[model samples]
Target: MIRRLTALAAAGVLGLSGASATASAAGGPPLFTDGHGLTVVSRPAWVDGNERTFVFTVRTAQVPAYSVMEGQVSGEHTIMVTLPEGYDRVATRYPVQYHLHGHPDRPNTVVNQRMFEETTVGVPLITVAPNGSGRGWYTNWRYPPAALGPQNWENFHLDQVIPFVDANLRTIARRDGRAVSGHSMGGFGAFHYAEHRPDLFAYVGSFSGGLDLLSQEQRAAVIASTQLPGSGTPTVPVESVFGPPIWPLDGGWNRESPAQHVGPLRGMGVAMYTGNGGDLTVDPLQAVVENRAWATNIVTRDHLVAAGIPHTFVDYGDGSGWAEGCTGKHAQPSCLIADMDHFVDLLMGTLTHP
Candidate 1:
């Protein structure tokens, strides 16, 4: 079925509303605004070699001052969606993969660069990437400064995006058909979502994810992210993000830490991957970053192991010899691609009804 959709999309037909390939190439107005405050803001294009792909800009009430997109700072943000093949003509409903982007990143990165559509070719899934804020940490900040609007990232993804996608797209709309995964902070998000709301996701994955939020360095990293550009003016206080940042369970950080809350993920499909933070090609500092994530990943893996939770853990050290083209680790694309492949493979066995 995916092959048929690919062939049709390659043939330049069946885009949303039956627009011509030539027209879609230009990119046009909104396709439709769903009830969830999300509007299809671009023409469906054959992006990254996939069929029925488009961008949706959502104006969520969750975070009134959400992260910026297209250089605009407002409550609204963009999300890139890659619909499954045969979505328009076929009546079959497909599983949903919510691919959250990392801190300091937007959903457009996934849509434009190297492209997820390229990876998902012939894979029967509807991939959605929501622009989690650059510093929101995918959590409902414990104490967002009263000056800036709320930073309810967790609510944004769970309450707003999920329902919008399920209602607007032909999705299975249940736990058996839903999966979440991410890179870096997104990796944290994958586990965070699975842990807090186990009923919403059947599979969870993190690629170089900071799984142990309670870890000293990991806590510092989250605090540092708030200093980055998208965290908004006045810089959301670290306490708002994770309590006092003091001892073991400071500011409710333990509540969201993946390692501390692995019980809900027992039966769910769990997979984690990280390199030894050996990306010499990138900034030398990236090594430190990846090394920290790798260390935290090990802690989480140990927790999962101790809990007897069945999961796939890949400690592909440094990525130097992981594969032919693999070199460097941490935020490298090669590692992320490998992580995505692994997650997809795991999802294939669990996602319902194909």
Candidate 2:
């Protein structure tokens, strides 16, 4: 499916040639570096309703050093920061939540797109959005560098990005000050990062993550053969992103699968928050091939039946939109804002309580 999207994008590039290519080029303002030579960018403060949006450009030197991205070079990361409104410079400590974006396939999607503006605004917390490599899984691929090898996405977020944010910003820099969440692929990223770095985050949420990345056998079936539907097949990119000894690479997948890592997460007292597409658009064939993405919460709820991990799952079919049956139809921002209100209330209520 990624290859198909990339191909379509390539085809669009071939046809349009000039406009569409640069329209969403995902590249923005020149890369800025911190005092430590870490590439960083701070955006003009955006004062919104109850939050301020600040952006950051993360340093990418550590990714290639860790051999994570196969061919990822240093000094090539972009991140965005959004904080609660009326932010004060006097505040020496504040909570930070790193947010990741979904794929329309842009390098700096965290800043380029507005798909998740509603989620961060007015949340009373600082938000960070780091750019994931195009079509890169938010995972550290086990395979060594080769053709289309890996993107070192996990290390990019954990090692470079988070440290940079903590160092530059006046943040609490603790597990409690840290929260991670995202929409779609970003959602998966949130869970994966939280699961791996339990010592760093007390709260984790996923808004429609492509969590089914755990189904390696199924993906292999799709990648190894070209009989799949809805997209073109490219074994090279798939192999590179997921890593090899293909076919049954559940180990690499399990590293990021929230379901597989549920035991440790619950043990670590990591709060889990997850949601799915109520009436919104989601890829088909989700149930057959990749069920874990949506079902993780359900399984999580059941698995944590005895354990007391804070968890919330919401579906937006309550008929709250202005002019419609579907809440997502006309005023998505309004509808999503309402949803965010409810979710935020739930999150604050749980996390703040003893």
Report, for all candidates in order, the number of backbone clashes: 4, 8
Please list the residue runs of candidate 2 whose C-alpha ends up more than 4 Å from where it truly belongs after superposition: 1-37, 41-51, 56-59, 63-75, 88-90, 105-123, 144-150, 212-236, 244-249, 267-292, 306-308, 317-339, 349-354
- Residue range 1-354, candidate 1, lDDT tens digits: 112222322322222232111122233312444556444444334444444576656666667775453475566677888765565556556779998887667777642244465566667888888878777788888887676577788988898789877665667778987999998888998899889999999999888899897798998998887665554444666687767788754848877888778999989999988888665556667788888898898999888889999999988886866654555556777667767766776786787644
* All candidates: TM-score: 0.85, 0.65
Clashing pairs in 1: 104-134, 142-240, 143-240, 243-251
Across 1-354, the per-residue lDDT of candidate 2 in tens digits comes to: 011011223222123221112221132321233643355434433334333443444445444332213333433455555545444422324467676664423333323224335553544455677766434457766553453333577876787667766655555566655677665566667777877778877777665455554454434532442222212112233445455434465455545556555554653333333323344444334322223344555555555565556566554432343223333232233433443445445444333211
Query: Cα lDDT of all candidates, in order?
Result: 0.73, 0.48
Quick one: best lDDT, which candidate? 1
Cα error, candidate 1, residue 90 (Å): 1.9
